[model samples]
Target: MKKFKKLFAATVISLAMLVAAGCGDQPTNEDQGDADNGGGDEVVTETPGDVGDAEITLEFWNGFTGPDGEDIAKIIAEFNNLHEGEIAIRTQTMPWDNFYDQYRTVVTAGEAPDIAIMHLDSIAGYARYDLLTPLDDLAADIGLEDDDFIPEVWDAGVYEGHRYGIPLDVHPLTLFYNVDLLEAAGYSEPPTTYDELVEMSLAVQEATDGDAWGIAMPVFWPSNMIFYSSLMSHGGDSVSEDGLTPLYNTEIGYEALQKMVDLVYEHEVSPSDVQADGEVTLFRQGNSAFHINGIWMIAGFEQQDGLNFAAAPVPTFGDQEAVWAGSHNFVLPKQNDEDPERLEASMKFIQFVSENSLQWAKAGQVPATYSVLESDEFKALEHQYNASQQNFVFPPSTPFYGDAWGPTGPAVDEAMLGQLTPQEALERAAREGEENARDAAEN
Candidate 1:
């Protein structure tokens, strides 16, 4: 797996200096209206004409360079048409890595877009760098209430008592099974428990006479996400509440990781040398009975001719039901000179997207808004809706949280490859994660 590196210290320092030199004190929760009230307590509804009489164009940026990009472009076109002469949104899309790298450069140079998209785990890091604007007031102005959104995703947008993101959608890891393979193995339904998974997997392997494997366990890509779901299901956390300590090197962690390695070595239901996306290819070609992947693959799977598959909520691999999930959220970048008109327009645009996210859900994502999730249209998306039912687990909100978790992938890789015992790998990861967190805090 590629390690996601942290932004350079020098770049962060320079960006901080630039923000300090040019921007004034950001608004506090109290300044936004009600300090004690939750989101949407003081609603100030506005129309397109509220942003003065003159037409304005807001620059929106994101990293949706996949099949979902087409979905978002259509939505943006509709949004642009609805407002017509009153407001327009100009979008800039790029790869996520390049988006992260260039975002800091643009912010430092006072060329940041009016609005952008950020992942739930990244909100705190960008907020810490003073590159994002708090959206409490804007959220309330658009009548965005906590009760109207998925609780996990809604709460994840806040950092240090201020809201920095408006969640767009959630994509969770789910179980994908070949229907034909299951039936061939005398199984009518997918497994719902660990014992069932093992029994069915072995049954399929034996029935196939080595023609097709039961599962394909990739050594990288989503291997870490699988480990995370297993850890959380065992009632273990990835980090401490303070977000400055590692917490996954315990007996629970060992058990969680060993389960994955055992799929290759002990049970022998999966190949030992599966690489990144190898499992995906195997599942598509009907060479594997089962595969675990994110819901985002639903669209691509549908396009694969003659692949008979269905999705289910991730089966219980531990003591509890938990699955790894992440959300994309709309955020406002800090501008050198705050424009009330653009801010209002951006909030309105966000509200529009949130309300109409059923269109976005067609791209195989679960809309974070409650109404959309409850809609008949969204419920019609059986695979995505099923995957959304799992107890979603998200990373702790902290600056450099991804960096702190970087060592875990290589550790998981080594364990899966049989280079080290699960205990040794997790211990090494925990120690290195602690050092990474400490360095982040000190810097």
Candidate 2:
């Protein structure tokens, strides 16, 4: 242990020297990114540090404040202790609802953590502000290849052909249905067809004879009403081909939403009382027939028993299939002064996390790095959902995504409350979403 401490101290010194050397050259926008992409240039080399020679601390923050947070904290503690004390990683948990505001304030004040897990959408501002380090150079040094990741999930790091974030995992919305409920109701398989799905729901309600609904999710959030989860299979997108107009005004989009309403108000198969935590709790307790949520809900699902459920890709309302997806990724937020040692260390940490991500995948996130996903252990995970998680889809992930969805969510909520007719609600939501997208584009 004493020797380990000595080596740790050496590594820290080496890292500091590397940082000092790194201060010399920071690449321009045109020079940095993955070569797998045609747009990036090589990053200059810096001095190497001995792992046991130095002492440096890094602050880390994330929004897993729920049960998932507890597990992540445990993983970090192990990482910190495993090192020779050369790398000291500290963690902070922020509530998901307000994390962005907190993150923005700190970063603007030049007091941001050495590393952080950020949403894929908000990084556009960070990139635009020139606040992050390019990971391509570091990736090349460590044999980190772009081909090692799911192209769709991996490309998330690239903005304007330059990569900013190192993706950790993707959490996509999936269909979580109660096993016993389906079995007892005389349904052996999940419905692949919409009409079959509705029929199965009615059967469950009739066979079980209770408040259990066919399906449930908050119907409000005008933009959410048109969320990507239910429409991906149909190749339906809420944005026009140019991404400058709202496409939800089309017959396809309205038809999709009308089906949702039918399941609720029309068929009376899905109860209205299930909202927010209520829906999750009911499903967790085996009180509901079906739930539409992301892989993150796996922990909560595990807490319940006699409650076998399976995850399937979202069904197609038209002729195709799709689902909503989000990624947890690492980015080097702008530093008051860029240091090479810190940058290299940050990259190393990211690589280490990616290599050891199986611990994370068990909690329900899809591995963003390909190595883990194709690893023997990952394949052996006892998860029934893995079979269907391969094809998660989200809307065009761009900086404008937040504005498009956030501002229009309230309009959707109002519509769910019956404050507007479908046409009126869709028109209003479309207008607001478009306006928000436009505002972001102009910036």
Alpha-carbon local distance difference test for all models: 0.75, 0.58
Best by TM-score: 1
Candidate 1 lDDT by residue in tens digits, 93-143: 765545655677788789998989876766777888788999998899879
TM-score of each: 0.88, 0.81
Off-target runs (Cα >4 Å) in candidate 2 are 1-54, 220-226, 240-244, 387-390, 395-397
Candidate 2: global Cα-lDDT? 0.58
Highest lDDT, which number?
1
Against the true structure, candidate 1 has what lDDT?
Answer: 0.75
Query: Lowest summed-lDDT stretch of 10 residues in model 1?
Result: 8-17
RMSD of each: 9.6, 12.2
In angstroms, the error of model 2 at 135 is 2.1
